[model samples]
Target chain A: MKRWIPFILTLALLVPIGAEAAIVVVVNNANPTEKMSERELIDMYMGRNLYFANGQLALRLDHSPKSSVRRDFYRQLVGKTVAQVNAYWARLLFTGTAAPPHVIPDKSEVIEAVKKNVNAIGYIDEADLVEDLKVVGRID
Target chain B: MFSSIHTPLRWLICGSCLVLMAWFISPGLVNAQVINDNDFKVSGFLTLGATRGGDEFLGFRRFVSQEGVFEDEWSYKTDSVIGVQFDKKFTSNWAATVQLVGRERIKNSFKESIDWAFLKYRINPNLTARAGRIGMSIYMLSDYRNVGFAYLWARPPTDFYSLIAFDYYDGADIVFNAPLGSGTFKAKFLVGSSENKFRFNDSAAEFKLNNMFGASLLWENQTWRFRYGFLSFDFDDSINQVLGTDLVADAFELADAFGWDGADNTADDIRAEGESALYHALGFVYEKLPWTIQGEISYLDTDYDVIKSNITRYISVGYIFDEITVYGMLGKGSQTSSRTKLPDLPDSLSSIPLAVQLRDGAQLLYNASYADQESIAAGARWDLRYDIALKMQLDHIRVEENGTVYWASDTLPDKDRAINIVSINLNYIF
Candidate 1:
């Protein structure tokens, strides 16, 4: 029984960490753009850039604020916690200078939204990726 | 008698109506439209704050006084505010926005004021233009000054912000954004005019600035941002009437006795007229995970002698821990007048009794420009919920030379003194 304690504790901690590693940024399979650098991603997400490299108006998607995947994605992409990003967006949103991305309920909805729109971009767990969505970038 | 209570109560009723309207529409509106795909979006923010201080601060009467004595009390009308914003996108290239904000003020009733009403047209992927009432970009946070939840401080430093009496201008602006190196560079050019009413004591004065123009440049990356701004305007204060004051009459009487042009000595002469004033500001922000640092320096100079030239600067540093952020700020400011002694009086009339009174009054006016202040503040912000934050702050301010910058009752002394203020606020957004 004592030997089982360590195994259970290790599994409990590693499970969440392993789950977090599966997050990836996804785009429509038809998007001519193959990949994007971290700088471009940050600029697009922060509202500094409104268009993709190909000059198409970019439509960014965000998961629900309560989702753990949404929190992890921002932390990995911009080194900002969920609260910090929210505060940052609040400033821009209230000023009419910029607007945050449209929020969908879960990873599957995000995938569906991205699949339907060529200019759309979203992030989801690696396990949620389907055939219609292309993995443009992976969150480390 | 009815003015004070009526304004606040009316504001409360208006606020209730807005709350009810938003509550009734949110569920249906949100479900039917995705934010990015929708043609219309509605959003709002509110901040409820209470401030207490050892002495009168920031034009707010902090205490009651009898005749020439002051007593300590709490003032709650200093920083409470509510605002709502609406945006409607007509097409991919065109959009319209309006924001209304309500707050307590000494002169205007608590009616919601239109902070911004503008139409935006996207010229290209890299260029855009907005026309209507837009906020002046003189300071780093000027775009979001009233959005308390966006910043780490409970309030911006009063000494610096109080210098500018106007916030919005009726004009147009164009913004250009480009990728520079590994960062983004943005340039904005704006031209417009503004008219504002400012209150001192119980009297309000109207100030107009015409042909107002400014430009701002910003460079930012993931961890750092740098901003520089310059603005110049043709100022006109000709219609400023000093209500409930006899100073103007006294000055005229003294001027007549000297057989000199009293017009030059009258209060009207002090009006800014078509004079020009220039303002320049530089600011930077650096943030990396748990640590953040930001600072700004600004200077203002006017062609008129009566208006004092001033310089102000502040630096703030903070550390973030999960949902809580703690910050400290240090600031200093000074104002100096150009005219040391009123245009040298004629030697022939120097001996007149009126000459002495005139000289004293002029001296009083010159002395009023003397201000040297320093302040230190510490504050903490706690994210209480998804969209709500609670903040508390304490400030220690020292008036090193004169207290002309701050609002104080007649009974309060104007000499060097230190004041302590405590403030708490709840900020939220929807």
Candidate 2:
């Protein structure tokens, strides 16, 4: 009976935890460029090099705190964790130097923010991409 | 041939073949269900630069490092550094981070080491507690000053941050956030002691593990923000007793030369006395259509036995125009002690007392002291690119003793001024 109970709980928990989702980079449709290399995307997102292909300052949008897509994107591209990002941002904020990218609650909000400004760029789950926002890059 | 001829040989050959096969195939098999959710990340930055300035009394003009060691005037070096941070999240409410910095300060120490290492547990939406090497809440820029790309200037106002250089403590802190009608307010409480030892002259200097407490409240909206903070530090005397004695002796020798046996030595007697300091700072930043300005003011008080109270204040203003930022600062402070009291001393062959000595070489010369200082600086930043910025700054300092200027040198180009500094820095982040 004890073994059976453990097996039942494992079955209930494993199903949802194993699911995988798509990762997509979203930029304003008005932005001239439709594609970006992984390196370019990294440079842009990390605040290393900010000029877009059209030569305008790229204002980045980020996911709200602890969002799954935010975690996935930074882990894959920037190679940092959420806590590290927080620490990094703290250093920036207190130093009166750089500020973090703007953040929105979810993919829909990101799309809205990006659609309004040509300089805006963000990422969302592949399933969440809206038509008005262009997908500039994809992470497999 | 041996395997075919003997059982032992056959077993050995079979084992060797199995090991070789496993080595090539095991890795692929092990990779089947590693289950990486892409929830870990790594990022970092590097800052490398050299500085030169005029009238560097004690080499105070360059970045804070050992080699500068209080040298005077023209110097160059790159003790600037690079650091990397790693962060991971195991669950929604739990996260961890480790930061490693490499700098020339600690014998080229590679371990900039654990600026913040802690496990954060969030009870609900508005509260969290973290225990580990927690950052101090004392000064606004203390936690982040090491990262240059985060700020427009090559460095923070040294006059303020340098006085209290210790910014991190090994301990735990709690934070609470509340919504206050169209704005949010946050409060943080930290209690801990520094585990590291700071040594001077080949021995550990005094740094008491006294209570360190601070409270700050910040309110922000789309275009405006205001913050106020108070920090109270309790510590035992950190000055070396031998050094204290030397200072006292110097004062007494000056007094004796003037034959002022009636003058007060209260200042000299206070040497080696335990002292404490309280620091308070306030700042307000405003951003609106086409303009952004920030102003900060700070006041600090240090109470020591022999020295008069030290009061210091710094005020700064900045304006943002597109990608260009222009700023300036005015700082002033003073340290003074009462001259009313005199230490009695025998004069000539008589035990009789005479007029209280006020001369520099008089016996009571130690009781009379003065330190009045003021600094003015102006600078600007131009963002040539998003991640790259160019900044230039010029600063002038004036020192006054009892309403009369002192210590001014010709190279400084101004009396009562020891140094005039011109600095330029290029800042970038990766």
Candidate 3:
């Protein structure tokens, strides 16, 4: 598992949220961020950066804990398994070091979560992407 | 490994502090988490472990506070534990966290389980400060050592991690984190007084650490993290079980005072108070897919004779294969400095019972504090499910002459022994 952590951190090499889930990272249209890199995406999702590229606070959102899309989203964005990511957060969370992103459920809820807050950023299936949500990055 | 404020009234005081901090942050630490989710959250982890083997009389120990490892018997006390955490994020910039762990750490009380209770205030995106009781962050894993599912080992290497039995400090610290190129750079500074523990059955054996100051720096990028930590404190311990309650220090002082034949007037060299010690460590972790490597080397330098100056180091390499991970580790700890000198008494004078005791006690104090030992281990971890893991390990250690102090035994061994320990553990998080 020690060795497994390295492959998980090489975020640039892999982008499959799952082997087949084509996902698109989305933010409220009100959010000025029009593009996102995996690095920037990882920074926000991993609690390293809480503000959007435009210097506005970002209310990061995620799928429910058990949601497969949520699992793949982290794998695609950071090359880490959901368990590894959870352990990482456990260290920070239990230590009062950082706050994890707010969690909403799967599907339209993930999209609705982004729409309700201008500072929100979330991921949804590319097919589920709606006009109300601005696509920042797409994971194949 | 933890000490909590005793008395029901104390909880009210702790609660009052909590309320005050919460009230203090409300007047617009506006960065409060702007989320709709419930602000209070709870989480926990558990580990069920048992170990068998090793010297029956010499007993294995993970912490100095532990009476002994289940010892040559399959006992769950060595690693079995459960910890629960509660967190309330008041705002984006303010929060409170408390963690309680249940284990066999002799305080045998609920208070001893309180490992962390602190108020966190984020000064900015790149800086944060915390107050109250917090874990001793002097080592790479000290922050989360109790969470078994977070790491790959059955337990931290004893030779290195167990050298200093301190658990947490009551004080404050400021942490700074910022992006450095493609990675992150973190710096921390802390100051506070730590705990003072009494042996389970012995009151004279008190361990007190005061006026502690510490700092650490870490640089991490994809696949690798490097860290260095430094801490110092004034230590005064009268552990009768090991060093005979300052007998060696007093013996030397008297011999030098009376100018014993071999005494070079160096009695004042070791004192009962004002003794200070410094600790420093360098550690690194690297991971790249199927393989990971981690290593750390730490040194404890002190003028005190009981602990003397000591150094410990370990390196672990692991490989993952599907749901299972296999790993091996090498570790060693040694006494680096000696603070005792034998008296040069004539054979005829040494025959006196008092003189014989002085020489033997001095010899015992000089050699008994040594933790010189080396160990090698192989282990396998199976993560058959998302939140659970099963681990099995076999450890072989060879103890050096007079190095039995690391064990739980009070009497020094007549001869060094080689021992083996077999362990199995089940771990989970929720």
Candidate 4:
């Protein structure tokens, strides 16, 4: 009961009430990588580990500021808010410990970038999928 | 001879030239972190803050190395700072990065402002090596301590972070990461030499750490992270340098005057030359959704008697409510009872000026480590935008007499007192 208080208050106190999309992780079709696991995606996205199962370097694409899909994606993936994710990256970024992922505000731009690079990994709303990309995993 | 490292104007010219070269090499430029299609990038962070309230004796200093001390006033000198970094990747396996920070520094020069300039060589997907002046990561937030946007609080808890300060070590390190169970295991071994220049009122002191060896181990999963670290270093010079007076000479002159010469824990134990010290720390963080909790405990062991051994620890808990985070923290720093004791001068000679000199000086030495204090803080952060945030914090600190380690005092009292401090910060990144 004590642990549930914060969770209950969060739902009751949150200010933004918008429709959430089912966020999906996608890769270039040219990539031979099979379905990625949650652990692998987390590692890649967070720069904890930069290699895929195929032993190839992985590049990640991120959503721009205030994107609803980005918020739901991090909350569903790591149980953290977008601000928390940014703070985590800031720890690594300013220190030159790791480089942040490239950001694309438009879904079309992300799709095109993914199609051009076999090492690229990105995510989007399942409803906005272009079908040319491979759906490796879902945030849920 | 060691003064050569203080040259900053030459470093500034070189830094400017290099930045210009990077700019021209990348004819096309995008936003921060992305410079055209080329592998060169630039990024920066800044914070302008207002801090007020504290005892006049307690100088508002963030760390020991900084020269500017906020003396119980509404001063911006203590919190306003800006930093810029340039990163150039030559190839898949080779890279170089340079970072420069501008703020109220020890010397207010480029040498003191340049935090990190290192060359990285990726050995494989799991292993990497870095040379040149590398950023030291003894604590969890040491890497990003300057980037206020990277943290939820207006500042890191003071009791723990302010205990000791060295920006980075001038040396090399190897970092390795591997999959261990459901989490990632990371390890680093580093060796280097570092220096800190501190100013207290009208006096200045220099502390140099030579022949330093350290190791850090970390393991983290989705919701839990743990870290253990160890560092050993030798003082480059007698810690009497901290007193800024010929304390060794004073100790010996008094020893000769008194008959208890060569006695244990007495004047004989005042040899503080080049003592080696060891530091160990353990920390952990648990974050899931709207809840976050983290804590760290560190111990410093030194054989030097006057400079007593020390320990510091803190724990913080925060709850996230969408764009705003409200957090509370508790932190403490104190001297351990593990030091050679100096018996009070015999009552017969207590009134003598020489005996008084030795006793008062020894007491001051002991009080230097006593900047002892226990503090509790509550703060709130509002993320106004993706790149900007506003934060305010209030700290109530109970100061113990003789702990000059954190405060500035002309004469330290043997009493304990309470003081409150408030800070407001606007943090941003680009």
> What residue pairs are clashing in model 1?
none
How much is the TM-score of the A chain of model 4? Answer: 0.82
Interface RMSD of each: 3.1, 15.2, 6.4, 4.3
Give one clash count per candidate, in the order shown: 0, 18, 11, 4
Report how far residue B318 has shifted in candidate 1, in Å.
0.6
Expressed as tens digits, the lDDT of each residue in A1-140 for candidate 1 is 99999999999999987776767788888888788888878888889886777888788888877789988888888888888888899878876778888777666777777877888988888877688878878877
Question: How high is each candidate's TM-score?
Answer: 0.88, 0.59, 0.85, 0.87
TM-score leader: 1
TM-score of the A chain in candidate 1? 0.86
DockQ, per model, reads 0.48, 0.06, 0.17, 0.30
Question: Residue B123, candidate 4: how far off, in angstroms?
Answer: 0.4
Model 4 chain B: weakest 10-residue lDDT segment is B27-36
For candidate 4, the TM-score is 0.87
Give the per-residue lDDT digits (tens) of candidate 4, residues B154-239: 77777888766777889999999898998899999999998867765445567789999999999988899899988899987645
Highest lDDT scorer? 4
Off by over 4 Å in 3: A1-21, A54-57, A64-67, A103-105, B1-38, B196-204, B237-248, B251-259, B262-270, B338-345
lDDT of 4: 0.76
Which tens-of-lDDT digit does each residue in B308-374 have in candidate 2? 4555556666666656778887765555444334334545513433223222233222222333667
How much lDDT does each candidate structure score? 0.73, 0.54, 0.74, 0.76
Cα error of candidate 3 at position B20, Å = 29
